[model samples]
Target chain A: MTISDNDDGGGTTVVAGTTGRLTQWSTKRNRWIDAIGISAAIAVALDVYLGIWVTPPDKVQGNLVRLLYIHPAIATVALYVAFPLAALSSALWLWRRTRSPFFDRLAVASVETGIFFIALTIVTGSLWGRPVWGVYWTWDATLTTTALLLLEFLGYIAIRKSTADPERRARRSAIVALVAFVDVPLIQSTMVWWKTLHQKATVLLGSSSQIHGIMAMTFALSFLAFGLLCLWMIINRYRIEAIREELEARRMEDAINDRIAESNIRVDDLLAANTAPANTVRSDI
Target chain B: MAPFALLVLILFAFALGPDRTPLINATPGLFWVAVLFSTMFAIQRSFSLEATEGLHDSIILAGIDPAGFFIGKLLAIGAELGVLEILTAAGIIILYGAHVTSMLVLLFSCVLGTIGLSAAGTMYGALVSGMRLRETLLPLLFLPVASPVLIAGTRSWQAGLAGEHISASPWMWILVAFAVLYICVGVVLYGPMEDM
Candidate 1:
């Protein structure tokens, strides 16, 4: 039951391209990351302030409407932003000319961050549903699709870990990610067609369903904060992934070198044995 | 796979307490579960067959169109599952006293559901075939995607058996849509996965 080991011709194409260098972050880059982090924090704080202090409570649902402030942003990031970024990166990796480890790293980073936001969406959605829908859980199409997407991401991450080699792992992960991406449209469409407890896209087409004027403003601010956080998290994750890949490549190189050394020692012994016959020619004379 | 499914059915009957009424009532869901797990293993075997050292390479060397190869494997899996479905159906009839109220819709649901499941299963099967966690990963990746099939299949059966005003809900359509979508995905995505 080995997974994808059926990719039979995976016969190692060992390209000795990179020397397994770790990711290097410059001071300016670090400062930029710091600024992004601070901006995300302030945005989230401001979003919280605007939602709790400034924005008027829902005329109908009172304080329970607070979930609206963060839920939509997280859900949008997880489903809309992260999922598409991964699919695009995977596509770029497969497009031959644009094939680079950078895209693969970016894909991984976005997917990892997407996983976090997905968890947040599910938890918050469930909490919000408890009061509004009476049941915390429903087999709603959108919820089901989101959960399936989470599983797909987990499967994607799992494949990356199972393959020990770096390049092969990246390629395999990219391929699987693309294969899984086929579901994204199916899920979104299913949510649209199937009438369920979970509502469809509210703010996408300017449908003034739940998000009205002031709520829309707060939603925009929250998206700014959370979107920045998503980007910052992806950058952090990408850097860490680059370092990990470098370490893996180094370990692979060390193993290859050790094997070469062992084989060379064996060749030396064989040569010495061949010369032994000449050294013993005096006995024959 | 058949024997395992049978065992699962046995377990279900036992867990529901040897009561006929309870088993009968639970047969719809349990039947789909048995079919799902059994067909999952068949799909896994279809993959493992290709993965036997050198076979996959030879097929690629022989220049087999991935679409034909995929359809062949899918049909093979579907055939095995058809047999399992019969056995599960018999188990339901005998053990749970399940009766088909709308034979036509039941057949439609079963066929479309099987196709949808096989389509998605084949894709995932190719993805996780020789993985270290093949068993675990197969179910983890497969079950979620295939849940729609299970839901639609079960609902179709439930709607058929109810014999109410509606002949059957549009679940058969959902199953058809699922089958078409995944088969198309396989056609598009599977060729590159060979390089994975």
Candidate 2:
């Protein structure tokens, strides 16, 4: 099978006979991705172990502080890492010099992965909130902004699905991504002025004065774990998007070929009728 | 837009029941909420005017500056929303028995917030105008982006109604900043969006 790389502007490439070389290249990349995923799982498991078993209970909150190992890391990946990468990719797609389907695919993959992590962040935060904040939710600035970001990105996905044309979909979603990204600053600024029940950032900002020793180590490890997981998920999602595009292009090609074959058969039928004197006479009548 | 705004205000009364106290206290929020909802319809109508007749393409082909087209639509929608807001405010005052203690702050918030809403609405309206699912998609794409306006507008009005003009000033600045930000963005980006 051959697929034209119109969307990516990378020129045409055959898919079948070159399978050996392609598989070798892809397998090498896949090995790295799999290794990252494995390490991520190990890191997360170790972080959990260290958090729940090894680390001493907090001076104030005791075992509840164990949530520190999970929630902040996921939030960091979702809000700070995944979203910014998506937005930057979107900007690159919008800029004429840097425009490519690669950036569009990256943006979509990052957003979808970010959505997953955002959902996890919210769930873990809610679970942690219930025992500490005494409620599952609040109208705090961080919470409200996070919820809105989720909705905005969900709209991004909705807009992506609204168009069937790949080019149009990429362009439209790129615009939406940038527009939604404007809210990030608005959210951050609100976190400063608005009274929030959510705790301030301590670990990531190097304000480890509040949290130190094994707790900090576990926290950093959790960040690395979730970050790697986020990257793995985005890479896999990007591959899925690329494969889906190729399948769509191949299906379109097969459809056009079938249409041409059908039209040729119609022409042959007309030629056969014209050559047959009896059928021609009946047609005259 | 005016009728829709009035309807929203009236519906809030029904939803809140016969208690005038809560309605009176919620007047500021209720009025802005009404305006926000009506702004969606206003934007829909504004874009539909160009869309139904394919005027969007004509305007682009006519060598009209995309920025001018953006600002023109922004102003038109802004004006319509301004009238709708006035009617909603009156409905709140008469139906909900709400008193406005600082008219200046209320007016400033109305003007600035309307500018922000109309600018953002116009941009989003253009973005989704060419889509088949625009009616459903516009609100989804627009409302969350406009939430800051809703918050800032409601808070400013809350302070305004309470006669605390000084306290309302900061929120008005937020309104100003949002308005300026969206206007500049719309002006620069409208050209490319139109090309799409």
Best by DockQ: 2
- Taking the candidates one at a time, how many backbone clashes does each contain? 9, 0
- Cα deviation in Å at residue B147, candidate 1? 1.0
- After superposition, which runs of candidate 1 have C-alpha atoms over 4 Å from their true positions? A1-32, A188-195, A199-216, A257-285, B164-169
How big is the RMSD of model 2? 5.6
Candidate 2 lDDT tens digits, B1-196: 5677777877888898989998888887787777888889999988888888978778878999999999999999999988888888888888888888888999999999999999999989988987999999999999998888887888888988899988887778778888998999899888888877
Error of 1 at A206 (Å): 5.9
TM-score against native, each model: 0.84, 0.91
Model 1's chain A TM-score stands at: 0.78
Q: Mind giving the per-residue lDDT tens digits that candidate 1 earns over A1-285?
A: 121221232333232454232244410157888899999999999999989988888888888788888999998888788878998998898778998888899899988999999989999999989998998889787887888889989988888888776667777788778767776666555554454667656567664656777777987898899999999999889887865664555456556765675666667769875333333322321
Stretch of 10 with least lDDT, candidate 1 chain B: B161-170
Q: Distance from true position, residue B134, model 1, in Å? A: 1.2
DockQ, all candidates in order: 0.40, 0.69
What are the lDDT figures for the candidates, one per model? 0.78, 0.83
